[model samples]
Target chain A: MFFKIIVFIIIGIAGGFIGGMGMGGGTLLIPLLILFTQTDQHLAQAVNLIAFIPMSAVALIIHIRNKLVEFRHVLITALPAVTASVLASLLSKRVEGADLSLYFGIFLMCLGVYQLVSAIIALIKKKKSQEGKQSAENKRELSENRQD
Target chain B: MKKLLKKVVVVVCSAAVGFVNGFFGGGGGMLLVPLLEKVMKCPVKKSHATAIAIILPISIASAITYIINGYFDWTSVLSVSGGCIAGGAAGALLLKKLPTGIVAVAFALIMIGVGVKLTFF
Candidate 1:
């Protein structure tokens, strides 16, 4: 039992770290619990949701102190988000655990592909911008040499 | 009219974010961060911060639903939450020192690999 608790804590640390980086720790947490432990899909999901509350509350406090949170925008998005979340959570309870895990697997794959693509795109954009700056600097150096 | 359309878009998108987060039990912030950054023109850090704010309430609502439906397990919740708190602080501190693009790519690859294993095996 102690060993099992240690494993769960390690998993939580991995997920929390990702989440702390703002990359959705729950996405990784649910899968890790389901795979590494004997946790049921629903239970794993529940753990992710509950664990996030305190973790995020701490981060939110820090962000608030730093003046990073945009309160006006939060309200606009939050109302609809809350309503939809409640309905979806209720719906999830009705789904079978195996089926839910299968669906979640598919969802995770899709999100991974999307993240991969976007990250590559961003990398390419960064490279192009850097190259543009280098060429512009080279051109300036050549013009300066001609004047000298 | 354009402003009204933008508001409509934000509402529709936020609802989608909530639905995904609720059904999956977490991840609303992933969808929300981009929406805030691109659609709402928020700075990256601000979007990340605001995402936590938006997701916090939605997560609480979903968690309540899950608990009401009898999904709560005390041991797992306590253990994981404890670890999460510790690791989250470390991650936040490390964020500034890391090269985000490379980390993002590595994380994406890991997600894909794990996702494939879960789906097929």
Candidate 2:
């Protein structure tokens, strides 16, 4: 019980960090729920969504106050995704225990890789763009000197 | 007019996310979270929560779709959610005590492993 509580808090913060970063926190939360709590996958997902409710609310309030939320943009994903979540939730239920775990594990493992790869790719692209801008600026300065 | 375009973008993007989410129960969030974090540059912790918040509406919408399609499993949702809350609380607390570096490293390793698995297996 104590271990479980400790695990939950840790997962929350990690999930919160990921959540704050906007990766949906489920990737982190679901795995922790499975590994630490020994919950089944579908149940883990349900728990993941349930835990998300309050956490998300608090996060949303902060974003709203900071003017970080783009309401129009948010709706774009939320409406359809929510609809999909229900369907997925239903479908997930029919999967047997081991199969559910295998699928969830695969999903998590894949998602984690995607996050890291995407982050790295984004960083590289950003660096290249910065370099391009700097080179352009230098060329502009050189041309201006020649004109002078 | 500009707002409309933005709304269109949202709808399109959300729809894409929704489609993927509907197809695979996990994706709406996985995609949304990073897009929000990287593109929006939302602060990590806050963005994490916000992603979930954003997912809430999307999840509900998807849930409805699932229900309409006759896929929703209330018993499963209830059981999982019940377990998750308790687990989530514990996970949240455990995070505070660990060194950030350790957490980061562990997370990174997991991400790398998962990424490889996804790409190959």
Candidate 3:
């Protein structure tokens, strides 16, 4: 129990930091809890959800203050995403530990790839918009020179 | 007046965050936490804790929605939540001691992961 407490704390710190940054902390927490606490996977998943209650609240408050949040988008996506998560939770009980970890790892890797890609896309789009604006300005200047 | 407006935004945002949080299952909390930290100017630790607090009502509401439609596993939620309460406190304290930068990078990595999962996986 004492050892578990120590491990839990370590996991928590790591998870909290990861969680704070908006990474699915469960990627770290679920495996760590299972390994250290020797707890059941379902329990770990449930614990992950429950723990998120507090963990997320703390983080959300900060994000709210910073105005980085998009409430409308959140609403649009919430139902589908929550439904997926709940459905996944139901199915998780039948899964094996290693299999679950593999799936989760794949999920994480895929998620990482997506973020990198989207950020690139967003950046590219921004650059294009800027270029478009500059070209428009150039055209305007040319017209003014022709008028003169 | 601005404070009042901000409060309204917070509630609406929080509700949306919660609802979306409930939908994603486990991770919208991560999104909300950092948004709180970065956008809302909340301290890192407080943002995390607040994310959880905001999530509860949303989860409950969503869970009820699930339950009405017969989607929940009461047994699973009970078991996992039981262990998580204790684990969370430890995680919270542990979070307090770590360097902020390490935490931030890890989060960014995770976001990248989430983005991948959402788009490709």
Candidate 4:
């Protein structure tokens, strides 16, 4: 039991850290729990949701201190989101365990793909903008020499 | 009028985000970020930060439901949360040193693998 606690703590920390970073550690938490711990898929997801509350609260506090969050936005988003999430949670309960696992797996795969594609695209856009700046600078220097 | 319209848009987007997050057990940011960035015209940092805040209440809402439904494993929740708090703080410190792009890719790959395994095997 103690060993299990230790392992879970480690898992939580990792998940928390990733989640804190806004990378969605629960994304990792659900699968890892299901895979490594042989936990039921629904149980794993439940843990992820429950644990996310504190993790988000902590991160939200930090972001608040840093003035990263706007309360109006929070209110607009949280109010409805919470209501919908409750409904979703109830619906999730009705899903079969195997189907839940399958859906979660599919969700993770799609999320992963989205992350990779977006990162690569962001990198490309960054490079293009940098190149554009460089070329524009070269044009300005050339025009200045012509005026001289 | 414009302000009210934007607020309405935010509300609608947030509702969608809430549904997704609640349904999936978390992932609101995926949609929330884009909604704020593209639709609400929010700054990137603010969008991400607010998304986290938005998730807090939503998470609690779903979590309560899960709890009432007896879906939680207390030992697992306790152990993981203990680590998560500390890990979150630690991750921030290490963010720069870590290759975030690579990490994202790796995370994605793992997701696909595990997702496939769970779905079929």
TM-score of each: 0.94, 0.60, 0.48, 0.87
**Considering summed lDDT, which 10 consecutive residues are worst modelled in model 3 chain A?**
A72-81
Tens-place lDDT digits, model 3, residues B4-119 = 77656655555555543343334456556656765567666555545555455555544444445444354434434444445544554565576544444545475455434433
DockQ of candidate 4 (2 decimals): 0.72
Clashing pairs in 1: none
Weakest 10 consecutive residues of candidate 1 chain A by summed lDDT: A18-27
lDDT (0 to 1) per candidate: 0.93, 0.58, 0.54, 0.80
The TM-score of candidate 1 is 0.94
What are the candidates' individual DockQ scores? 0.83, 0.21, 0.11, 0.72
TM-score of 4: 0.87
Can you write out model 2's per-residue Cα lDDT over A1-148, one digit (the tens) per residue?
5566656566656565654444445666666666666666555555455555665565567657876565644655676655555555566556675676666566656665665566566567768999999999999999999999
lDDT of 4 by residue, B1-121 (tens): 9988988887877887788777677777777888878877779889889888777788888888888887877799888877887888887778888877667677767777877787788
Q: Which digits, one per residue and each the tens of the lDDT, describe model 1 over residues A25-87? A: 898999999989989999999999999999999999999999999999999999999999999
Candidate 1 chain B: minimum summed lDDT over ten consecutive residues — where? B110-119
Best by lDDT: 1
What are the chain A TM-scores for all the models, listed individually? 0.91, 0.73, 0.63, 0.80
* lDDT per residue as tens, model 1, B3-120: 9999999999999999999999987887898899999999998999999999999999999999999999999999999999988988889999988789888888888887888788
DockQ of predicted model 2? 0.21
Question: Which one wins on DockQ?
Answer: 1
lDDT of 1 at B59: 96
Better of 1 and 4 by DockQ: 1
Candidate 4: stretches off by over 4 Å? A129-148, B1-12
